[model samples]
Target: MLPKIQHLLKASPAVTALIGAGTDPITDPVRVYRHGDAPQGVVRPYVTWSVPAGDVENTFDGADADFFRVHVDCWSDGDVEVEQLAKAVRAALEVEAYCAGYYADERNLETKRYRIGFAFDFILSRE
Candidate 1:
């Protein structure tokens, strides 16, 4: 797991509240996980992220900085629902670039329930 991913997980109080943790009961508070294996049974609405590949560099100050290719996957039962969840995630990440920005890539799923999926790619930095 990426260290930054864990950091975001741990530092999620504000986000949790904003995304409906204690206030809403049905949303399940937009569950989040890292490197979670898909179960043999059911998969609920959630967000999963992973570091596909990355590099660590030792700077002149003798400290290492890690640049990771992070992929965030958002899943829900509806398009608007998944999009709302994705928006919340993108807001929390708050990442930006001059040329590259957030884009939604839809995925098709074969399941017992109708599902919508969205993906986002980002270069995450950790020192």
Candidate 2:
């Protein structure tokens, strides 16, 4: 699920324009990582995400789908940049997932960086 989300964000023109398409997508500026995995000194305006909750849906017949509640955070050096990055992230994910909505928009006092966080719900077919 995280890989799928990363692929969507990496492929989005809007997102790439803001972040970047590094020579190597895996190590590039768009810099999408699972929460707490981004390396120190990463480029600005990057993205980090996590699945805080999830469930397996089963019917009388069998399990059919898996549901995940994902949190995506955008970090940037400026307020406006963070907002734009968040919008791009939302746009990329909303194509294949439902956006529960934004949950946080604040500046980290210690780092002086803006962070915007949002939630998304994804239902993936087991089959």
Candidate 3:
């Protein structure tokens, strides 16, 4: 699932490159990167992910179940133009959402990160 999502995002024209592990020494302990066009005036935003939901299940008659879950988050550094940021996010997610062919899904904005803060969280499931 992680590879699939990474591939989809990496294939996007807007995405410039994928900064995998052990490239940066000054960054966090997670895999981070600068994605999107840089020379073409695209701000390479900071991207990170966490698997907050692990595979587990309730105990009923000593039964076991498995579930796949994760969260992929991307955020821009410093103050960037809201319009550009929105366009960048839409461009990235458009390809990630199975090429939805439209960028009009639901989004919720959180102000804890920026002056005009926002975070796009897409809950995905593949059966």
Best of the candidates, lDDT: 2
- List pairs with backbone clashes in candidate 2: none
Question: Which residue pairs overlap in candidate 1's backbone?
Answer: none
Worst 10 contiguous positions by lDDT, candidate 3: 28-37
Model 3, CA-based lDDT: 0.39
Clashes of 3: 0
Writing each residue's lDDT as its tens digit, candidate 3 over 23-95 gives: 3545522223323212232233434434444455556565654443334444444344333444554466555
lDDT of 2 by residue, 1-127 (tens): 3338878987899998887875576665558888635688888888889988998888877758889999999999999899899988999999989999888899998989899999899998877
Per-model TM-score, in order, reads 0.61, 0.89, 0.36
Deviating ranges (above 4 Å) for candidate 2: 1-3, 25-29
Cα lDDT of model 1 by residue, 57-126, tens digit: 6778757565555666666666666666665565566433111244345655575232323343344344
Off by over 4 Å in 3: 1-3, 17-44, 54-69, 81-86, 96-127
